[model samples]
Target: MSSSKNTLLIILAFFSIYVIWGSTYLLNKIAVSELPPFMLASIRFITAGLLIFIIAKLMGKSLAITKRQLINTSIAGFLFLAFGNGIVVWALKYVDSGFAALEISAQPLVVLILMRVFQGKKIEMMSVLGVILGVIGIYLLVSQNEVVSKEGSILGMVMIFVCMVSWAAGSLFVGKADLPTNYFVNTGYQMLAGGLMLLVGSLLFSESWSSPNVWSEKVQWSMVLLVIFGSIVAFTSFNFLLKRVSPEKVATSTYVNPIIALGLGWYFLNEVITAQSIIAAVVLLTGVYFINTKKKLVIFSRFHK
Candidate 1:
């Protein structure tokens, strides 16, 4: 491909990742009404994993990875997909889609803090300021009676926090671990490994398959869409963007998702979008901007590693 074409492809990949992943919050809430959240996520990822694995093989990609790589990737998959994603899916049952997205939007800041602690990376002072702003935004979000009045909303918020932290840890570990040269191959294996673990968790923790609402067509199609768009296409494009763009640029998607989710909620479900919520969202996004400033610094040290 020519330089112009390569740049265009990268831009396209970034938008695809941002739009598709942002849409998953609404889809998750829709699915959870008639399906067990964990079980639905398990089915979505398992299908997506198998689809990606098949596509990779058809493209003449190797499935085999080093044992060390497999172990590391599997651990990341379990933490990020099973724990991070699972918590989000489960939280959706108790929280509004837009609120859930807003809660999890703190992920970029969390990743920065975790990287500083574990990787010995220097964090920018601006990023610390951003974290403070972001926390204040979250307090505003929770202060609203709408969120705190619900029985499980507080627990739901806690679960979403777990999702954010676990995902940060997963990303850090994946960055540290040796991964496949091919992004598709690495993603496929990780999805497969993660999906299997989620499946086990679903079976142990949920009676989804036996639930009266298990086989609803509405729920089934939602799972199908989540797999095709949310898991496979969204994630594959996102991993591609991680390599082609700066982490700060990639992190912008966290802020974007809440807007998308809010719009979808208002349009599809007639959910109310209060003024307070919008203000809180902006504060949160502003905080994220500061938090991601650390990635903008240029490093020229040969002794860094």
Candidate 2:
């Protein structure tokens, strides 16, 4: 690829991840109102995964994977989608979509800590400051008496925190795991694996399944958008960027997603954006910026050395 083409592709990919993905918090929130969380997620991922395979096959890409790669993708699927994403969808029933997005914005902080805990990676000074600010930001977001006092809100917030952990763990795993070389094929496997597990979860929970014809118009639209743009387009862009750019730059989605989610939720869903939520967003994104900036510096030093 020429430099110009690469730059253009990078811009497009970043837009997909930043805007489309940011909008998915609201999209999932909309769909989950009329559909069960696990069921909603399963349908979205399964449809997207199958579509990916079809697209890949049409483009003459092989979908074959080693057994170990399949297993790794399956594990990532469970961590990133089944548990991490599904439970957040479940929590949308209780929390405002904007609030949920804001909470998830702290994922980089969690990933940072998880690296230290699981891999014995040294926490640098910048990251330590990030950890401190993340704690404060999280407290500001979750400590609202009115927010948590809502029915099931506490549980929702706690479960979202768990989802963050699962997502962060999945990130760590993907960094080191052996998987398909083709990002599209790799994403397809993970989505399929995650969707299947989500189906099992829905069955285990005895959640009612309804036909799309019975779903509300808004929900149907939300599901379509989630499956197409959110899952297939934006997620593939995510994997693409992960390979093409620095990790810190890819992590910039963390800074933009919540703002987009907050705006979309407040505008479309009439979700309240409390003053404290604004404070939390600032503190949280700043912390993430500190961490990402430090990361970029570290990578630059390594490359130059």
Candidate 3:
């Protein structure tokens, strides 16, 4: 493919991930009303993982890899999917899905902080300012929603913060790991590993899976969409973008997702969107933009010789 084609695909992949994954917040809210949140997420990921694995194999993608690579992929998957998405699902049991999405929108800024603390990189001044603005935006959004009590809101915010940190670390680990040569194969195996961990976690945490009969059709359909569009389509496209573009660019989807979710919630679910919510969205997006666009720092190492 030409450079132009790759760029177009990259952009499309990013957009697809943003839009599809964003809508999942609303879908999850509907689904959890009728189904156990964590269990539903487990089923979605497991099914999507198997589907993607089969597709990768049929496409003749190589899945053979060293033990180290397998371990790395599993770890990344566990962190990204299990803690990232899994914990968010769990948190939704206590908070509104839209609120959760808005909170996670701070991920780009979190990534910057993680890089500084873990990777010994310097935090850019713009990112520092961006984080401040983004945090204020989050405050405005949550205040507008009033989805939980003040105390519960504080806890919910903390949970999403942990989720963001886990996700950022997982992404960085995946970038550093020597994983599958094929992007699809990597995505397949990672999802499979992550989904299984999530299933086990749900079993251990919830102690039992609720019967399907207990769920309404709306919930069931939402789970189906989560599996099809959220886990399968969005994740595969995300991995594709990872291959075609810089990770920083791919990370921009984090900011875009909240807006998409906010819009879909308002339009489809008739969720109320106040002026504060709109202002928060703008502030958060601007903050994320500053974070993602910051210039990298280059340092010489004495060991380079």
Please identify model 2 stretches exceeding 4 Å from their true place: 1-7, 244-249, 294-297, 300-305
Model 2, span 1-305: residue lDDT tens: 79999899889999998899999999998998889999999999999999999999999999999999999999989998999989999999999988888888888777767767777766678878987898899899999876988999999999999998898787767766788989899899989999999999999999999999999999999999999999999888876776665444565686688899999999999988889989999998888777778565565334222
The clash numbers for all candidates, in the given order, read 0, 0, 0
lDDT of 1: 0.78
Off by over 4 Å in 1: 1-6, 210-214, 244-249, 292-305
TM-score of each predicted structure versus truth: 0.90, 0.93, 0.88
The alpha-carbon lDDT assigned to residue 148 of candidate 2 equals: 82
Clashing pairs in 3: none
Candidate that would win on lDDT = 2
lDDT of each: 0.78, 0.86, 0.75
How far off is residue 247 in model 2, in Å? 5.1
Q: How would you encode candidate 1's per-residue C-alpha lDDT over 186-255 as one tens digit per residue?
A: 8777788888888898889854564435467766677777888888887777666655554445666777
